[model samples]
Target: MAGLAGAPADGVAQYRRVVVWRHGQTSWNAAGRFQGQTDIELDEVGRAQAEASARLLAALSPGRVVASDLTRARDTGEALGRLAGLPVTVDLRLRETYAGRWQGLTFAQIDEQFPEEAAGWATGDVTVVPGGGECRLDVAARVCAAVEEHLRGLPENGLLVLATHGGAARVAIASLLGLPHDRWAVMSGLANCNWSMLEEMGPEKATRGLRWRLAAHNAGSLPEPVTVQEG
Candidate 1:
């Protein structure tokens, strides 16, 4: 409601409402592995989480669904699309930040194998990662760009949904809120199936020229009983 703006002259939708949600939990999540770019499928519980999220969004009745191309996000988006009866568009730019050599490893393992990188990240250094993986700043820039591109195409008053990963989502949130990359460590990871909302305001009211206001941040999963009732 707060993000409503005038439509663009070209009839391309201006900003209205955007919902950002993290994909459901994965097997690797419980196993404490760094799943960046690993392409793991959702486990049984994860699937249930995805279905529940779909039911929740269906109640909200969004106009469009967009998601990262990764398996976890795609699966989640598919479930939501099925429930909401909306088409799902995949965007590779929304994919999770690559962890490089740190992929599939636990925090303890990373600390043991790549001590310097681990320590740098632990200290909130945004530019450091093992091997060639993306830094927090890099992830923020690309994800912000992707969101901007998606928003530019939608009509004003449109409701849109995005399903993505934790790290990239965090970076996007920090960018939206104008927080420094170093603050990424202080922000909590988006829970599995959690939702956040943002609105794009006009230039005059925008804090950063291109106004991106966080309307709802890190909302937890929809209750199963409520979802069933809505369905």
Candidate 2:
């Protein structure tokens, strides 16, 4: 992530808040397949997850919805858009790292077939391009670019709901937070339809090197049930 991240600045608050939402699960995800850039639709559970998460996120008053152009992320974004009455803007830059030859392969299959390559990426090499797929740093670079561009257009106090893949979300966040490549995987993957919240802290907290605060991570839950009291 070269130009996407910057040194800590006592700069103005750029983004009010960012909700990085991972798209719901597909059969590939359930089967532990490397679903990079493959256009897999949501399964039944995935659809439910999207609907549930969308209901919860709508309460946050998201002013914008942006998502990867893939089918899984797009459908998840559509759920949020339908609920929040917003429109989804698709960006190919937000797409998951192209898995290349591993596009439709399962974890076991990759290990058995391409153990060396799988081990390299699994150990956080970040440079190892699985089956000649996009490198982790490359994914970070593009995702950061797309997300930062979207944040710039948001008004003050506006929340941006971003629907994308788990890998893309992890890379983008790690880059924006200025974390080293080796430590990027320390941030766990987001479960299907789960979300992480990043807040742009104002300059009052200048002592902190970075102004980005991870307010929430792996948050997955629907809105609380509405119960009426009879007096």
Candidate 3:
């Protein structure tokens, strides 16, 4: 929303579009478990979701595929990588927020065990360190950094898809788009196998303090051109 919309600039390219994809559902997800930094694999439903969504994303012809090293994220990335004929580059920085003691606990269980922390986390409090785990800001920092590194290899008009967790995707999108930590809660969580897209606005827009523009969020389908009728 912050950058100009039109055809991409010509000549040497330094910017690229990005897709931050959330991994498909695991058994833990259906069970309402925290699963933070847990190496959970995709369940049957998750596999189905990944296969279907991969078909859709593969149409975009993504140039690079990257993912968290965790099992769930890696498997999800593999789905797309297989279709796009790209290898998934794994990075520990892209892992979900390590929720320390909260990992593997159900939402209700977390509330019963860590009442105050659960309350704060539910409100999207960036300062809340879940069970003494990484805070939202910390997650954003590392996630965006990994994304930036991958962007360097992206070609002109190329798309880089990142298969990661819900929390990681949300925080990374907010941080990369220059949204303050307090505004991060405005970004709704991504459903299983859904994705968000960001487009770099080139150096000209960066001079105006607008770097990346969010093209889509929590989307299951590719974006289409908008058509409006003049009244």
**Candidate 1 or 2, higher lDDT?**
2
Best of the candidates, lDDT: 3
Candidate 2 wrong stretches, greater than 4 Å? 1-15, 204-209, 222-231
lDDT of 1 by residue, 130-205 (tens): 5478888888888888777877767767778889998888878878777766576776678888878787776667
lDDT (tens digit, per residue) of candidate 2 on 15-70: 58888899998999999998998899999999999999898888888899999999
Better of 2 and 3 by TM-score: 3
Worst 10 residues of 2 by lDDT: 1-10
Write model 3 residue lDDT over 54-172, tens digit each, in one string.
99888878899999999999999999999999999999999999999999999999999999999999888998999999999999989988988998966868889999999999988
Better of 1 and 2 by TM-score: 2
TM-score of each: 0.84, 0.87, 0.91
Q: All models: lDDT?
A: 0.79, 0.85, 0.89
Q: What is the TM-score of candidate 1?
A: 0.84
Q: State how far residue 37 of model 1 sits from its true place (Å).
A: 0.2
**2 or 3, greater by lDDT:** 3
The order of the candidates by lDDT, greatest first, is 3, 2, 1
